[model samples]
Target chain A: MADFNASDLTCLRGERLVFGGLSFAAKSGDAIMLRGRNGAGKSSLLRVMAGLLAPRSGALCWNGENIADDRAAHQSRLQYLGHQDAIKPVLSVRDNLRLWGQLRGVSQLDAVIDAALHALDIHHLARITGRYLSSGQKRRTALARILIGQSDLWLLDEPTVGLDRESCAELSQLIADFRATGGIVIYSTHIDLDVKNPNILDLDDFAIPMVEWLTEHADLNDDTNDSANMQHSVSPQEAVQ
Target chain B: MSGFMAVLQRDLRLALRQGADSVMVVAFFIVTTTLFPFGVGPEANILARIASGVIWVSALLAAMLSLERIFQADFEDGTLELLALSPVSMEMLVLGKVLAHWLTTGLPLIIAAPLMAVMLNMDQSGFVTLMIAMLLGTPALSLIGAIGAALILGARRGGVLVSLLVLPLYIPILIFGAGAVEAAQLGMSATEHLQIMGAILLLTLAATPFATAHAVRLAIE
Candidate 1:
């Protein structure tokens, strides 16, 4: 069964501490919902899990192997849908899907693209340019890429964003079906997703030691006489503004 | 290999659907070449003398026009991230797109150069040399341009930035390309210039893609 594990992870974006000392695991037929307010680093955490961004300190493993050791092999069994649609406007819908399948080494690319388009309800627009599609249509086309190959793990960041109710419901069912087939899904969203026994990881619970450290350092600097001199060196009118 | 073919096919399909873009690029090449004669006062001697350099420069600019779109669309749509995440090395992906770019833009210019040469009053030998020079040089332009494209993926004024960054790197190609036609025009063997252009193409083919891939990764980050 497909599974992913993250251990003692710490991530930082410049001086801001997004999350630290966090750990999570997702297994076959399991769905993980990462919930947090904006700027809580939900997306950053997702990127780390996807191996797109490296954590300052941690280990991400797939199955029983360290993902870093066999990155290509681990990546092959996974599909990630990020915040953007990632469609090429100049390309027709069918050609886009065909390329995705072919790149992943999926056999019978035409059949795979056809199946994906049919599933996404965009079969009629297969020959249309991506630039001409609506926002929702573009999102569906991006979703079609996930359906092209047989990936065991799916990392979807706001997959339902910009989708209509019907489309959202369709996507929910698709994720459900994938889980039922023993595929692993880790998705992040602000809205509630109606799924059974969902495991929730709230980023708010993760501590940001880096932020505290920066604040403390600033406080120490403020107590020094040089700090007053530096602040005073600025013209009064300039400082006031 | 399948990964390479997939990228090649995807880019080619995109170019084909755009329909007028490739044609327009070739048209730009011809129109720009034609402008030099009128601008320089319809002197056949002057036209013949400057034909090689004029054609090479025009071809360079036309090829640059399309390079920005090569990775910009993919990067915006998140396909670049997926491609990077794919099992195929980013270098191979870059190479595939570069090959496709040459097929669409570079090949057409090479094919259309002869007609432009005729219009410019270029010598027959110079016309053949111009075609051969473009055939050798334009792929290097496309390959080197990929690095600029990837570097400026989400930057403000990316189109202008791509040209500014790439045009300087294109000088070696320009020198050899124009040199070949000039040698042929002067009744000297153009083989040395052709060899130089071919070497530049080989070096770019080996190095530029990795640099492009790195630039793309940084841009995405």
Candidate 2:
């Protein structure tokens, strides 16, 4: 019965309104493929969803209640992987997963770490410290942290940045298995990924029209205060344009 | 398994694995304090006269040495972002990391300060006072330094900027700390200075986590 939804969300990065009038919803077992060119706000939108960035105005809800009402509770239910794979350089791959597993309060932790390493096919590299990892191995280590059932929702900024084809296939299988267990995944990438019947969201369709937004805001308040109303009169439905 | 302990354990393990971070801090403490006696001439009177100041200043800088590492690696590799997404409040996570930094860096400086004092020809009467003041003061260094460390998380030349921002804030601890030992050396009651340093430690303990956590959250954004 769990659902993830965003309503009337607008994001501003510094003075630029990255995206405005954007809304999306997905339920358990859903996969959302967030597609866009660089700077199209795919990353910004994911960060906003994760509560890492405060959207200019929006409501993120879970099960019909505002997620902002209980930010910690909302965050505890999900995991996020950004472009930079969060591997600690000194800890071995196994220890990195163990640290996260313990933080998430996962019981049977040894088994979980073992299974996660196996899923990503990085089990043999578990004993080596992260500093020695190749680019693909580092990405695999980052992926293993998510495979351990620590959180049911995943917000991946670019999960496939350094993954090889075999590794990509393994990751896609992991995601599919997660969905089979009622997990929700929202991933952003420029390359095609092997996802099952994904709900596609191209961020270009939802960007703030910079020239129009500037003229409209300049008319309202000439200096410094124009950022507050940049999303005025834009409808989420109009984002389809 | 608790988030605080998990972070603390990881940081300490990393510190041990890296192995050289704590050694480098202690080495800096020893080397910097050693330079003073030679520069001021081995006259016990002059060395003793400046002993407290030299030790405090060196320890202060030594604490700054490892502050950059507090968030730098995690920030660079994006572990900090995952940490942000955890159920643990950023403030608690900051506290754990600060405690780990204290154990690795501040604790060693405390162990080394008294030895440096002896080498600098400090008065025997002031030795215990120096240890007490440092024990109280170093935690404040780690705590206050964490705020500076986090504020400069993504800035260019973060190491330099952390020292610039943190060194000024360290003045109060340095004053009260060095003042305590100097008072003891002069046969005066050092209790007031020691009490003030204790107060500063308490204040930083209560306040810096929130400030550091706010900075950490901003860096993540």
Candidate 3:
């Protein structure tokens, strides 16, 4: 089964502390939602988890193996869909999806792309140039790429951003089905997602104090003193609450 | 390799769909070359003497005109990020783009330079040498321009910045390309200059991809 564990993950953007000393794990068949306000580093945390962004300090492992040590192997099983759609405006929807599937070494990409477009209700638009597609259609096209791939982990950043109400409902159901198939999904958004038994990580409550402390002592050396500072800053009540 | 072919195929498909883009690049080359004669007057000796330099400069500008789109469109639309995240190394990705650029712009210029040479009343030997030099040199132009293209991604006024960053690096190509034709005009074998251009092409084909890949990553970051 696929599982990801991030231990003591601390991320800093210049002097601003995004997240610090955070930990989380998601096993196969699990869906986790990352909730926070706009500048709360939810996207940053997702990037760090995907191994696309490096953390200031800590480790990220996939299936008990360090992602840093085996990046290619880890990346093979992971698919990250960021805020941008990543489609080539000059190419047709069919070409874009086929190219992505081919690059990822997936066989029968045509059938897979067809299925994905059908699922997204965009099969008729396959021959159209991506530049001509509506914003929501383009978003659905991008999402189709993720759906067609056989990745174990899906790191979706606002997967439902431009979807219509029916499309949004369809995607929510797709996420549920993916989890039911024993795939792991970790997504970040400002909107509340309707998922079954989601392990919600509310960045607002758990993140502010940690980020504030990290911002203050960002220059502290990686020694016992830093740990002492962390302990002194967070009392027992603050730790749990 | 399949990865290389995949990238090449994708780029070609995009270029074909945007037919006017490639056509405009070739038209720019011809128009720019035509402007020199009008500016310098219809003096055969002067035009013939400066023909090699004018043709080479026009070719360089044409190549530069197309370089920004080598990765900018892809990068802006997030396709570059997907390429970077793919199993294929960025170096290979750069190589694929360089080859595609050469096929689209550089090869056409080489084929069309002779027509421009005839129009300028260039000597037969000089025309042959000019075509050979362009064939050897334009690939190097495309390869080196990839690094510039990758670096200028997301920069303010990126089109102007791309030329500013790339023009200086193109000096060597211009020198060798023009030198070969001049050598031929002087009745000397242009083989040595052609060899030098080929050497630069080889070195760039080996190294520019890695540098371009790093620059692209920095741009994304």
Candidate 4:
């Protein structure tokens, strides 16, 4: 069982302190739900944990050592599925997944790709290029790579947006399978996911200081307090809860 | 090694599938080289005098035309994030992409340069030197341009910005590539010019991968 821990993490996004004093820990077979309104720093927090964004202050420990000591080793064990689907428009569905598997350094590819495509129910669309796939299909194609790669930690950001009901259930089962196999899963969503019980880490609690900082300066800006977690894409104002 | 080859193969496949980008690069090289004869004159001596310069300049522009897209497609589609997280180091990843760019963009320009030289009525003695200079010089263009492309990721006017950023660095290659041909025409060995271009190529091969990889990480952040 692998151990993953993040302690006293503060994300300094752009020029502002997006979130602060955040911490979460999980071992294999654990799933932590990142609950927060938009810019309450859910996505940014995921990026930081994914090693894409640098935390202003904190420690990310994997197994027993700090990730910074051996980032490639840490990254090799993780897969980050961000807001974008990461599909190549010109490549066939199979080629896209195949390339991803190759980049992950996975050998014996045929079995893995077949299993992944089957898990996402995209095996039938294997020959189609990305340009012709519908939005939902693209999402499924993107998710399929996760199965092929079999990363230890999956940092998914709102993965169910374009999935249909059946597809959503399929994804839930896939994640459930991943967890049952002792993989650690972390995700962000506005609505509930159909996983078994999950550990919830509300980013709002960590964002208290930035909200305070905003309010302190709201005296001059006036509008900063009105829409507290103002952000586009997911419209984070509702995340202040 | 497989990771590097994986990226190289994937990019080559994408280049083949899209087709238009590669075609446009070759087209620009041909069109730009031909326009020079019209701008100056059709006189054989004049064309020969300017052939090496025109071909080298056009090749640089052609390589730049596709430079911004080397990482742009991957960056836009979020594949760059995945690449960053891969077991491969960022430096290797950058080098892989640069080599891939050379195959799709620089290789095509190299194939077209000799023909363009003939079109410009370049002296027969200069042909070998012109090809040698371009073969050595174009990789450096792709490598150096990788840094500019990586820097301007997601910028609003990335095309123009890459030109401003990359053109100055490209001047040295242009000078040496044309100078090699000029030396050959004057019945002198172009060895020194070719040697310096090789130095620039080796330096960029060692250096730009690290710089471009750094810029890519920053852009992703």
Task: Give TM-scores for every candidate, taking all chains together and pairing residue i with residue i.
Answer: 0.89, 0.93, 0.91, 0.93
Error of 3 at A186 (Å): 0.5
What are the candidates' C-alpha RMSDs? 4.3, 4.2, 4.2, 5.5
> What value does DockQ give for candidate 3?
0.54
* Residues A1-241, model 3: lDDT tens digits: 8878888888877677776778899999998898888877888887777666788889998888888887666666778889999877788899889888877888888999999999888999999988899999999998888877788888898887887888887788888989989989899865666778889887765464654574366465344677666666666757789
Which prediction has the highest DockQ against the true structure? 2
Candidate 1 local Cα displacement, residue A109, angstroms: 3.3
Query: Which lDDT value does model 4 have at A161?
Result: 81
All candidates: DockQ: 0.68, 0.85, 0.54, 0.78
Residue pairs in collision within model 4? A37-A239, A38-A236
Which portions of model 1 miss their true places by more than 4 Å?
A14-16, A89-92, A117-133, A207-210, A215-241
Candidate 4, residues A158-241, lDDT tens digits: the string is: 988888889989989989999999999999987667988899998888875655555555543455545434333125554654
Q: What is the TM-score of chain B in candidate 2?
A: 0.98
Task: Report the lDDT tens digits of candidate 4 across residue range B1-221.
Answer: 78888888988898888889888999999999989978998999999888888898999999988997789988998889888988888888788888989998888888888899888988889989988998999999999999999999989999999999999999999999999999998899999999999999999998888999999999999
Worst 10 residues of 4 chain B by lDDT: B87-96
| lDDT winner, 1 or 4 | 4
lDDT of 1 by residue, A1-241 (tens): 7778999898878667788878999899999998888888888988887778888788998877888888789778888999988777777888767777877888888888888888889999999987899999999998888998888988899988888888888888889999999998889976666677889999888866553444345643565775666456555847689
Fnat scores for every prediction: 0.77, 0.89, 0.51, 0.81
lDDT of 2: 0.89
Model 3 lDDT tens row, B23-62: 8888999999999999999889888999999999999999
Q: For each of the candidates, give the backbone clash count.
A: 2, 0, 0, 2
Better of 1 and 3 by TM-score: 3
- On DockQ, the stronger of 3 and 4 is 4
